[model samples]
Target chain A: AQTVTQSQPEMSVQEAETVTLSCTYDTSESDYYLFWYKQPPSRQMILVIRQEAYKQQNATENRFSVNFQKAAKSFSLKISDSQLGDAAMYFCAYNANNAGNMLTFGGGTRLMVKP
Target chain B: DVKVTQSSRYLVKRTGEKVFLECVQDMDHENMFWYRQDPGLGLRLIYFSYDVKMKEKGDIPEGYSVSREKKERFSLILESASTNQTSMYLCASRYPGPYNEQFFGPGTRLTVL
Candidate 1:
C-alpha cells in the first residue's frame, strides 16, 4: 500500500510572495509519478504540476515548481509570486505500478493568500 | 479542451433513500473515476471504470456502487444513502496509459439528511 502525507493542515502567504507546501509519501515502487492539484472555492480541481520519478530535474510550470527528492521520498510544491487566486486546497498525489491509473492523495493543505 | 460534467452541482437526500450521481466526459477517454472528498481528507476513490461495463472498487468502496453502460458516462449509486455518505463527489476521466493527467468535473455536493 502507498500513502501520501501532507502534514500542514493550513498555510498562509502574502500576495506576491513565495510559499512552499510540503509533501511526503511512502511507496515501495521505484518508478512512479507525483502530482500537485489545486482546488479552489469553485470546487474544481486543477492540475498545478507533475514530476516523473525518473527525472532528476525538478518540474516547473510558470510560477509553480516542485522540489522532488526521490531518495528522501519528498515532493514539495513551491509557489512563487503567489496571488490571491493561488489560495486553495493543495493536494499531493502519487501513482505507481499496478495502481490501475488511480491516484493516492494526501490529506491536503488549505492555503490562504493575504493581500 | 477536455470537459467532464456532473448531472447536478448540489443534491439533498434523506437517509435510506436511493441516490444516483451521474458523470459524463467529452474527451473520449477510456478511463473514468469516482471520488469523494471531505474536510481534511483529500480525495478518496470510490469506484472506477476502465471500459464500458467494467468497474473496479477503489480505496473506499463500501456503501457505494457504480454503473457504466457507456464509455463516456459513469454513475455512482448509494443504495441506501446514509449521513456518513454526505460529501462532495467528483468525476474524472483520462487516457488508458500511465502518467496521463486526469481531467476532473466541477463536483457534486451531496447531503444526506
Candidate 2:
C-alpha cells in the first residue's frame, strides 16, 4: 500500500510571489508517477502537472513545476508568480506504473494567494 | 477535451433512504472510479469499474455499492443512507493505460439527514 503525506494543511502566498507545497510518499516501486491536482471552491478538479519517476529532470509547466526526489520519496509542487486563480486546494497523488492502478492522494494543502 | 459529469451537484436525503449517484463520461473511457471527498481527508476511493459489468472494491467500499451496466456510466448506490455517508462524491474516468490521466467530474455533494 502506498501512502502520500502532505504535512501542511494550509499555505498562503502573496500574489506574484512563489510558493512551494510539500509532499512525501511511501512506495517500493521504482517506476511510478507523481501528480499535482488543483480544485477550486465548488469547481472541478484539474491536473496541474505530472512527473515520471524515471525522468531525472523536474517537470515544469508554465508557472507550475515539481521537485521530484525519488530517493527521498519526496515530490513537491512549486508555483511561481502565483495569482488569485492559484488559490485552491492542491493535492499530491501517486500512481504506480501498472494498469488499472488507482491514484493514492495526500491529505491536500489549501493554497491561498493573497493580493 | 474529456468531460465527466455527475448526475447532481447537490442532493439531500433522509436516513434509510435509497440513494443513487450517477456519473457519465463523454469520452469512451474503459475505466471509471467513484470517490468521496471530505475536509482534511482529501479523497477516498469507494469503487471502480474497469469495464461494463466489472467492478472492483477500492480503499473504502463499505457502506457503498456500485453498478456499471454501461461502459460510459458508473453509478454509486447507498442502500441505506446514513449520516456518515454524507459527503462530496466525485466521479472520474480514464482510458485504459498506465500513464493516462484520470478526468474528474464536478462532484455531487450529498447530505443525509
Candidate 3:
C-alpha cells in the first residue's frame, strides 16, 4: 500500500511570487508516476504537473514544476510567478505502473494567493 | 477534448432513500471510476468498472454499488442513504492502459439528511 503525505495543510504566497508545496510518499515500486492536481472552489480537479520516478530531471509545465527526489521519496510542487488563480487545494498523487490503475492521493494543501 | 458528465451538480436526499448518481463519458473510455471526496480525506475510490457489467470494489465500497449497463455510462447507487454518505462524488474515465490520464467530471455534491 502506497501513501502520499502533504505535511502543510495551508500555504500562502504573494502575487507574482513563488511557492512550494511539500509532498512525500512511501512506495516500494521502482517505477511509478507522481502527479500534482489542483482543485479550485469549483471542485474540479485539474492536472498541474507530472514526474516519472525513473527520470532524474524534474518536470516543468508553464509556471508549475516538480522537485522529484526519488531517493528521499519526496516530490514537491513549485509554482513560480504565482497568480490569484493559483489559489486552490493542491494534492500530490502516486500511481504505480500496474493493472490497478488506481491513484493514491495526499491529504492536500490549500494554497492562498495574496494581492 | 475528453468530457465526463455527471447527472447532477447537487442532490439532496433523506435517510434510507435510494439514491442513484449517473455518469457518462464522451471519449469512449473503457475504464470508469467513482470517488468520494471529504473535507480532510482527499479522495477515496468507491467503485470502478473496466467494461460493461464488469465492476470492481475500490478502497471504500461499504454502502455503495455501481452499474455499468453501457460502456459510456456508469451509475453509482446507494441502497440506503445515510448521513455519513454525504459528500462530493466525482466520476472519471480513462483508457484501458497504464500511465493514462483519467478525465474527471464536474462532480455532484450529495447531501443526505
Candidate 4:
C-alpha cells in the first residue's frame, strides 16, 4: 500500500509571494505518478500539476511547479506569484502504474492567500 | 472537456434511510470511482467500477454498495444510512490507461441526521 503525507495542515502566503507545500509518499514501485489537486470553496477538484516518477526534471505549469525527488520519496508543490484566488485546499496524490487508476491522497494542506 | 456530474449537490436524510447517489460521465470513460471526503481524512475511495456491471471494492466499502448497469452511469447506495456516513461524496472518472488524469464532479454533501 502507498501512503502520501502532507505534514502541514494549513499554510498562508501573502499576495504576489511564493509558497511551497511539502508532500512525501511511500511506494516500492518504480513507476508511478504524482499529482497536486486544488479544491476551492465551490467544492470542485481541479488538477494543479503532475509529475512522472521516471522523469528527473520537475513538472512546471505556469505558476505551479513540483519539486520531485524520487530518491527521497518527496514531491512538493510550489506556487509562485500567488493570488487571492489561489486559496484552496491542496491535495497530494500518488498512483502506481499497476494500481488500476486508484489514487492515494495525502491529508491535504489548506492554503490561504493574504492580501 | 471531460465532465463528471453528480445527481445532487446537497442531500439530507435520516438515519436508517436508504440513500442513492447517482453519477454520470459524458466522456465515456471505462473507469468510475466514488469517494468520500472529510476534514483531516482527505479522500477515501468507497467503490469503483472498471466497466459496465463490473465493480470493485476500494479502501472503504463498508456500509456502501455500488451499481454500474450502464457504462456512463454509476450509482452509490447506502442500504441503511448512518450518521457516520455523512460526508461530501465525490464522483470521478478516468480512462483505463497508464497515468491518465481523473476528472471529478462538483461533489454531493450528504447529511445524515
Across residues A27-84, which tens digit of lDDT does each residue of candidate 2 receive? 9999888999999988999999999899999999999999999999999999999999
DockQ of structure 4: 0.69
TM-score of each: 0.98, 0.98, 0.97, 0.98
- The iRMS of the candidates, in order, is 1.3, 1.5, 1.6, 1.2
Cα deviation in Å at residue A5, candidate 2? 0.3
**Clash counts for the predictions, in order:** 0, 0, 0, 0
- Clashes in model 1: which pairs? none
**RMSD in angstroms, all models?**
0.8, 0.9, 1.0, 0.8
For model 3, the local distance difference test gives: 0.92
Residue A11: error of model 3 in Å? 0.8
What candidate 3 gets wrong by more than 4 Å, as runs, is none
* Candidate 4 pairs with clashing backbones: none
For model 2, the stretches where C-alpha displacement exceeds 4 angstroms are: none
The candidate, 1 or 3, that scores higher on DockQ is 1
TM-score for candidate 2, please give it.
0.98
The residue-by-residue lDDT of candidate 3 on A1-110, one tens digit each, is 88899999999999999999999999889989989989998867878888888899999999998899999999999999999999999988888987366888898899
lDDT of 1 by residue, A1-115 (tens): 8999999999999999999999999999998999999999986798899998999999999999999999899999999999999999999999995666779999999999999
lDDT accuracy of residue B54 in candidate 4: 95
DockQ of each: 0.71, 0.69, 0.62, 0.69
Query: Could you arrange the candidates by lDDT from highest to lowest?
Result: 4, 1, 2, 3
